[model samples]
Target: MIASGCDCEIFEAGPGRVVRRARDGRSLEREAAVMRHARRHGFPAPEVLDADGPDILMERLEGPSLMEEVASTPGQAAEHGRLLASLLRRLSGVPAPGWLQAAPGGPGNRLLHLDLHPANVLMTPDGPRVIDWANAGRGAPGADVACTWLVLATAPAGPSLEGWRDGVLAAFLEGVDAAAARRHLPAVADRRRADEHISAVEKAEISAFVARETALT
Candidate 1:
């Protein structure tokens, strides 16, 4: 296996291809559809070759995830943050198809990657390519930005990683709509709080972070 996540494992399938298989045996049709839609709109998403049941065959991305890059070179956190912000901005411009479900909080025509974060971005020779469309849907762009902020701010991290999160977040907010993020933060926090994969400690931190951020805004 090339890598593994909470719900999936990536395995090299052949030259330029990899298979992402869900651990819990869920269909990947929706994820594939979202990726194809994003790609059709010129968004940077991995090319989906096939999706069947729990497995999605996609073009193999070369190089490290944005998170891994930041972890190794802390000095580049700000640069990566800007890149992330730009990616979010680009994604927000894509019009959502009717088949895509609406996310919590508000109705919008924009596409949203509810799980977007550094770990989901791959820094390739061509550019940054976004991966993992499982949580993608339709929502206000700000809500998506708020989701990214919440993840960066409250995800459980080690000492070194924790130290750099603030810097990355600050840089990212500078490039995006900070006010929008603040506006939608409460709803995002509530959604994250109910996530089954989130730890209790992280959930508590998310609540505190949301409260402080919203109050300041």
Candidate 2:
């Protein structure tokens, strides 16, 4: 077994296969379906080999995560940002599958990766491949982008890593409309607040940010 998270445990099944067993069987099934859909649409995602009950067997992608690279290779911050932005653009352009539904108060038509962050992206030989589809669904592109921005902005980092984060955010927003993303911040923050994974301190920070941004708008 390689990694274990709150929801799932990942194991290397063999040279080409990886097994993901989720505590919640339904969520694992949903994740497998989402990956299959993404792959069908030419998105960079794992190929699902089998999905039985709570276990999902998928193609093993080898490489460091984008988060690892960003923390270790500060000089490549801009490049990573560009790559992430491109991936977001591509994901946003893909039409959501019929079974997907938007989160409450979010746009219902656009495909959204609600939890897309550096840690969820793997730097593969082919390129960066997005993983962890647990929070993906149909929603506003701005909401998705805003969620990413929030994650980047609020992530705990040391003094040394702060500059890298800033560079990445700067590059990410180079061609993006800051206003549009900012507009969704409050909504995204609200959604994030309800997540069990968020700590009380983090929730308080997000809530305060939302209140401040709401007043300005």
Q: Point to the candidate with the largest lDDT.
A: 1
Model 2 over residues 11-120: C-alpha lDDT tens digits?
A: 99988889999866654778788889888888998999999888999999899999989989999998878877788888887788878977644565776788888999
Alpha-carbon RMSD of each model: 1.2, 1.8
> Where does candidate 2 stray beyond 4 Å?
25-27, 158-160, 212-216
Deviation in Å, model 2, residue 188 alpha carbon? 1.5
Q: If scored against the real structure, what TM-score would every candidate get?
A: 0.96, 0.92
Total backbone collisions, model 1: 0
- What's the distance in Å from true for residue 77, model 2? 1.6
Candidate 2, residue 90: how far the Cα is off, in Å: 0.5
In order, the Cα lDDT scores of the candidates are: 0.90, 0.82
Write one digit per residue (lDDT tens) for candidate 1, span 31-86. Answer: 99999999999999999999899999999999898998888999888998898899
